[model samples]
Target: MSAGDDGLVPDLGRGALTDRVRATVLGRRTPRAWFLALGLATLVSLLFLLGVVYVLSVGVGAFGLNIPVAWGFPIINTIWWIGIAHAGTLISAVLWLTRQDWRASISRSAEAMAMFAIVLAGSYPLLHLGRPWLAYYLLPYPNLMDLWPQWRSPLVWDFFAIASYLLFTASFLYLSLLPDLASLRDGARRRFQQLFYGVLALGWRNSARHWARYEQAHRVLAVIAAPIVVSVTGTISLDLAVSIVPGFHFTIFPPYFVAGALYSGFATVAIIAIILRGLFGFRDLITRAHLNRLGIMMLCFVLVVDYAYLQEIFTAFYTGEAFYRGVYFDRWTGPYAPYYWGMILCNVVLAQGLWFRRLRESVPGLLSLAVIADIGMWLERFQIVITSTHKDYMPSAWDTVRPTAWDWLTYAGSIGVFFVLLLLFIRLMPSVSMHDMRALLHRRREGGHG
Candidate 1:
């Protein structure tokens, strides 16, 4: 649906993606703003490289973890990053499969985040390994050591789960990009930009026939990716649930992890949107209306988390199970009480404010919530990782895992890395999916309700 499809109001509900997509991809506008985005993103990328070097040279031991708290920063970071990773394809592919047109603008960032988040997250499991080089042992291979990977282990499951997600996310990101790349290829004025996008376009002509086939294939891929994101993280949740651990071993783990993933993922998206809008001056694209839509979704996610947290506590203490009760007590009335309370305040108290219509729509308020929610989600993951391990069945093995400099730096560097990659994605690529947005807007112009 082009802008001319409908004689009536066109592109009204089409969202920011369609409004500015043509200018972005065709290089119709000036490049001064993009140059600035490139410079900032480059600086952040350099910092990320330095961080990786330090992490590799120093070894995983430089982070935190003793016998009981063996899974600390790396694991926690993995969960948080992976959670943030889910929203990309989850919203893009999943929602697209369900025919949610409002998701158009957010899908590009969502898909990109899935790629980088997995890249960043996939590193931690290897980094935390005793012999990082020997990490491939998790893969299932016959004729290898007589000792096969324990199918019962979550760590082993995570290897396949994350790997599958990374592949699917990469494929999904590329598929969505091809059309836009074609638009850039056909429209770019500069020789270098033409050459760059031309390769990605793969000799495509942006004919109506091509767009039709591409859109159909894209819809199919989204259908595949949506469930993959949900299932992948659910498997991760089982890594904790199937265990003998009290706070963990339950059917709720699947939904709990899924909800947490959305909670963290949407928050990360909001943070990215805020940055992209600020740096790129694409307030026309990543507008307040779009932010409001996502903010509301985030608001809902937090509520789901809060509800889940309550049920978790209720089941633990109310069930009369000694193990669950003990875990609950250890977290609530124990040394980790401060962190637990912080989680409650941040995740619950702040979330309740979204009940008011104004707060969800406010820029400053939504921005603050997005940043705070990220911190809250990180702590929530920490609560899951630390609380469970800190008060395990064996009291002798229980100990607090305080982070070292390496842990903090590595995590800090990842923050820089996400922004670094995101900033570049904004400059070099369309942060918003232009082709899809254009179609949706075109349909809207034609008076299509969707």
Candidate 2:
């Protein structure tokens, strides 16, 4: 069997795969679509600047941080972006460990997405703090005022959790890019391009010793990253679980949050993979088989999420706690009923399309559903935060909350930043893992394309 037989990388060989990926970064002229998307993202990203300026000058009062619902769009967007980041790291680390060949085609881009998404996610926590300059207070620093982060606070937990994930993600992304950077350094036609890539590559000779050491370092990094998939979000879940509120207090939050994060993260990876595959003419590399496998992975998570939902409802009733029962009731029929139902349909009901071979194989169908699932995930976060916080144990604390224009602007701006980072990544590096693809080619020659 050849590479093309199993519908992976068709007509694969070292020279062809290297040339195809290198051209994306080293080419003189970039695609028009890249320019248009970057321009739009840049424009929208300015909204972040405007919102920050207003908040800094006018204080956090410029936005809609009301009494009952203090955590609004900013918190919601933060959680959503963090979940997206997890998907990339999870895919790259787990798939590589399990020896999945399809991961070779998408792992580079996925890791890049994780890094950029986490960077964007980091911005919200500070921005949500009205006095953004005082953000360093979250850190455990020795000070004359004797102020330190409360050891038991979930906010403090979140700070360390995000910091840890970001560090690992950056290391993982850099390790994966070393070989490709070396490729760019050698293949560059311009003097500046050679210098740039050379500095990034750190003088790689591609010797046997280099390959052996690189593989060892890569494995160690993967080992360190594997546990983060469970730990980071589990820490985030603590932010809600420790609270005395009805909907927020639940034992299932840790696993539920992790399952939802991976579910949404995989959908995001699919959407980006589909776009990049189409734009760069990487049809053979990111084949239907890859998409099929991704769909099945998402289906497994969908069943897990459904079970989580059932557990939440059952536990609420079985425990017979009015606060928990009332919160769930409001979640189903409260002011945000549309968001609740929309989340269910998009994530649970509509995702049923993945069960069919024809729909899963259809690029357009999966793309549309992936996008919907992404939105559904965001809604899930929104419902979880708002329903629990909006109406507390006391009736007097109940208040309706809505995001103001500034809130929306900040949210939109974070999205802009995410896309700008993603677009730059697409333009500056090989979106596919080259060395991994070479291994795939070798395996295919030995009749192991399956």
TM-scores, each model vs. reference:
0.90, 0.96
Q: Per-residue lDDT tens digits of candidate 2, residues 1-450?
A: 544666766576788889889999999878888899899999999998899888889877777778788888778888888888887987888778888777889899889989988888888888888787888898888999988789889989999999999999999999889988999898998999999999999998888899889989989887777889888888988998998888889999999998888888888889888978877888888988888877887888877887998999999899998888888899999998999999999888998888987877889988987888789889999998888899888889899887789988988887888889899998898898887788778787766642
lDDT of 1: 0.77
lDDT of each: 0.77, 0.86
In model 1, the runs with Cα more than 4 Å from the true position are: 1-55, 142-147, 448-450
Candidate 2 residue spans exceeding 4 A from truth: 446-450
Clashes of each: 1, 0
In model 2, the Cα lDDT at residue 159 comes to 92
- Give the least accurate 10-residue stretch of model 1, judged by summed lDDT: 3-12
RMSD (Å) of each candidate, 1 decimal? 3.6, 1.8
Candidate with maximal TM-score:
2
Q: Kindly list the per-residue Cα lDDT of model 1 for residues 143-177, writing each as its tens digit.
A: 55586899878878889999998888888888888
Positional deviation of 359 in candidate 1, in angstroms?
1.7
